[model samples]
Target: MKLIFGIGLFLSLSLLCYAQEIYKESMSLMGSDFEITVVSENEQAGAQYIQIAVDEIKRIEKLISSWDQSSQTSEINRNAGIKPIIVDRELYNLIERSIAISKITDGAFDITYASMDKLWKFDGSMTSLPTPEEVSQSVARVGYEKITLNEDEQSVFLKQPQMKIGFGAIGKGYAADKAKEKLMQLGVKGGIINASGDLTVWGSQPSGKAWQVAITNPMDKNHAFTKLPIMHGAVVTSGNYEKRITLEGKTFTHIIDPRTGYPSQGILSVTIFSEKGELADALATSVFVMGIETGIDRINQLPNVECIIVDDSGKIFTSKNIRINNNEN
Candidate 1:
């Protein structure tokens, strides 16, 4: 009777493990749910790895987060235009990358957008369009060139007094990348790090199948546009569907173009596929602001980078090598 009972328990456990389901856990960290999903594995080990990933992500939040009043990034902001503050190596590297991207994009991607005055409100309170003068002045302090970086000392300085830098565009991606690294180091066979909508995945399904991720339709949130098979890389999406303001019959998106000091218009959503989550995250925002034509050109110039763009009229455009799996289930 004891042997029979043990065999029955083992069979029950095997049945439970074979069920096709999304094994997920949510942790309150990095100002949101640091979500992890594994195809099928040891549940205890998965949960432990996710917890460790969340801890690492929150550490990044503390390092690069600008919204947090007590973060080290705040120290840099406080010292802007007054003194240069030496930052951690990680943040120093991220800031350096941001500046480099900004230059590469000709200031289209800027971290100094915090200096813009609250000229355009998308919170359903905007009544009229910002005047030309207001738009020009808003971007006056928004120049990546003014951001000074010292490589040897690992320091950052803002030339203007009111200038400030925020990682809102790339923080989530950075966290996701860091979390992915930690999980890989811990010997996780299969896992995903999803920081909000920015996500990176690795390994394969238990049955040795590639992991597939669905791209949601911005116009119809209930539906997916396509499912992309991801083996070991990252994907990031920037969309204007959730945040927009209508002023004087003109619709403005939440994605602000730093060079023009106005919200980006035309494109509805932009998705970037890259080997590095941080680059994918920042590029998604940059390309969304750059619009379809220029965006595709820019992405094509970069190696191992691809993009999919949906315009306001629902027209879809993709880079040369992007393959869309349209099996909607």
Candidate 2:
């Protein structure tokens, strides 16, 4: 008999309503549901594999969660500005990659954005815009260049006294990448690890079909505007609609522009597809802050990275290989 065999007819008939031979499990992690799925000849086997992947994802989240206050990442943050603190290999690499993207985007994508003070409230309580000095002071602590990385010692340092770093934006993608890696290491041929909306997948369905993913319409969250195929990589979407606070007559998204110390405007959503989830996650926010023209230009320069951008007017733009297949036609 094969190591994994197809479901018997009796078992298949019991769960006939399921459209695909897929098994899925949803777990709570990183403040959202982390879902994993495996498609195989047998639903039972697929469920077992998905559980394994979800377990590994939960394990990683516990280690790296900054919100936990007891996690390794939080420890590094607590010691910030005092001395260089060594971190795990995973966090060290993540910081390295984030700095590289920050350099490439001219500081538009910065992990040190946490250094900004909790000023410029966007709740519907303010009547006047913040003064230029207030804006400047808020971002005085948010320069990625001030973050020193000692590669030989694998330590990270924030030069300013009040400076801090957080991984709220890129943590999901890193978790997705780790989950996918763990599943593949377990000898699973194909699966998807979705950390919130940051997801990665590889191989083919047991039926040899491509994995399909839909891009949401920013104006209408209920409907998907496009469906794209995922052969062997990752996809991540960031939207201004998700987190926002309104003040007076204006609405400010939670995504801060590191340069201005204010919320970004114009773009509504950004979706990135790349070979690595980490790059896709970081690039999605970077492109949103950079706006369309510069965003497209930056993504075009990177290897194995593609982006789909929706502006405030709902205008859609895409990179070379990203096809926005409107399901209407």
Candidate 3:
């Protein structure tokens, strides 16, 4: 169904001052909300930097957006099984990394997920489950193994005619990382690039306090219970509590497994902290599909990466390196 989804609401710590004020600009980009914050000397400089950040994100969209018919991503899909499409080096690198991640996650996170046919509805309209044959056929063309990459030619090709790729899950985070890089290169001392709930922050706020993220309590769903202080890193939280598909008396989230062609269940939300927003965003979705136990174990194996999982029972789980303290701000 070409689903474009993001996490729940996240609250950021913002502090301002007269000498060096914190300026923020919020806008819609890549079919999702984005906020760019920077530490600037005055309102005029802040405006210019924000515009620069916005322009960089727009450039990324032009490269990776599947909805845009002229985008390179669309061209790759159009040439599936016909011929390899030469793409920009940036795009080739992104696809290469995506394939690596797919291998490690055991098909839980696959860009070829776009190859799946939309056979289920999440708006309570689906009262009966699709036949087993229908479910299997929906994901027949969805396989990461079918995607081929040639580094020498900087080209991408799909072995199957119906195979397709989309970056709906990781594109926002990639754009956020790119925007942060552009802002930092232009001499912006401190800032944050928040693409919906996937965020990347560096330096500190103008008031000198470390950047903090307040994750929503799954039990409450509306109010945040704990605040996590991050000196510098990326945090991406993915959840499916808002949308669900009902078949018979069972309920399923909107996040479908590309391999099994079934909705992932058991975990309510997953928040991943990593060195890059792209990794954090993809890992968050991967954890959801991997379930609670396996997800925590996989995250613990990676160095400098941690995750917080809230299961359907409102119970919280964390990786080996994480320690949640509600007392600490």
Candidate 4:
């Protein structure tokens, strides 16, 4: 029910490539742990840049957080069936993009999933599986197709009274991307904005090497199975290893399929690589919900995007473009 292992899902395995000091600051933001790191020998400048990143993340949280009744997202949810809620262009664009992603994933990734009531618990509170009828009712109010958006007014409205939306699946990655963009705009050469596990990287290490990302074994998270370099890009890993419940001797992951209203199965972890953290974050969850073959097929069709899937049996699967052992950076 809680978070991380979302993007920077794999243990962040950035190697210290240069002698330049790596200054990092950690904070809890948007109900998740966030670590912002920048490479610079000047301690003062690094601290300032980190603070700037922190501020940007906080700004994003206030704009999109559903937990805060004052946020635009909450407003949209409150006015779900009553009237269209006008929102800032930034949020409108974000929701538009989210819907686009929903179309691509065929409802595997949905923001309207927030309408689902707490039916399954992973904290040992859930001992029995929800009946199929209960599962169906849980997702009755959740559907991307039910969302109505007016481009002219830049407004959002839910078709159902109980319908709601949230960015928990993609918010961290969006925050990471925005923070990285702001830092880069300020002329920060190289650094990492890791929102929980949703991570974005740019520039080069002090040694002039591209940033490298390592994939963790679903069986053994501490041991990375493969490492790939992603410079000026983002990588997000969504794993069911940490949040799951076993009922009737069947293990169910926390990633529930909004379309089916059942917990996701078959895959233990999904890691997506793309130029944007927002897309990576959404795709990771989508692929996890889509299962192995379909997820790999979907990722194969997308350009400049790749994914790694670990199934329940601990089998490793990667997209066509990914070279398992060879260095592709």
For candidate 3, what is the total of clashing residue pairs? 0
Off by over 4 Å in 1: 1-22, 39-41, 324-329
lDDT of 1 by residue, 26-88 (tens): 766767666787654566766677788878887898888777888778888888899988888
The C-alpha lDDT values of all candidates are 0.83, 0.81, 0.86, 0.88
Predicted candidate 4 versus true structure: per-residue lDDT over 27-120, tens digit per residue:
9998888888898757898999999999999999999999999999999999988999999999999999999999999999999999998888
Return whichever of 2 and 3 wins on lDDT.
Answer: 3
lDDT of each residue in 1-329, candidate 2, tens digit only: 34234556546654543344767777877788778877655777777787777677677777777677877777767877788888887778888888888999999999888878776554655667777798899798898898898989998888888787887777778878887887788777677888776779887676667888888899899998878778799989999886777666778887789888888999999999899887888889999889899999999999889998888887888887776565222
- Model 4 poorest 10 in a row by lDDT: 9-18
Cα distance off (Å), candidate 2, residue 266: 0.7
User: Cα lDDT for residue 19, model 4?
Assistant: 46
Instruction: Name the 10 consecutive residues with the lowest summed lDDT in model 1.
Output: 320-329
Backbone-clash count (model 2): 0
lDDT winner between 2 and 4, please give it.
4
Backbone clash numbers for all candidates listed: 0, 0, 0, 4
After the best TM-score superposition of candidate 2, give how far the Cα of residue 126 lies from its true spot, in angstroms.
6.3
TM-scores, all candidates, are 0.89, 0.86, 0.91, 0.91
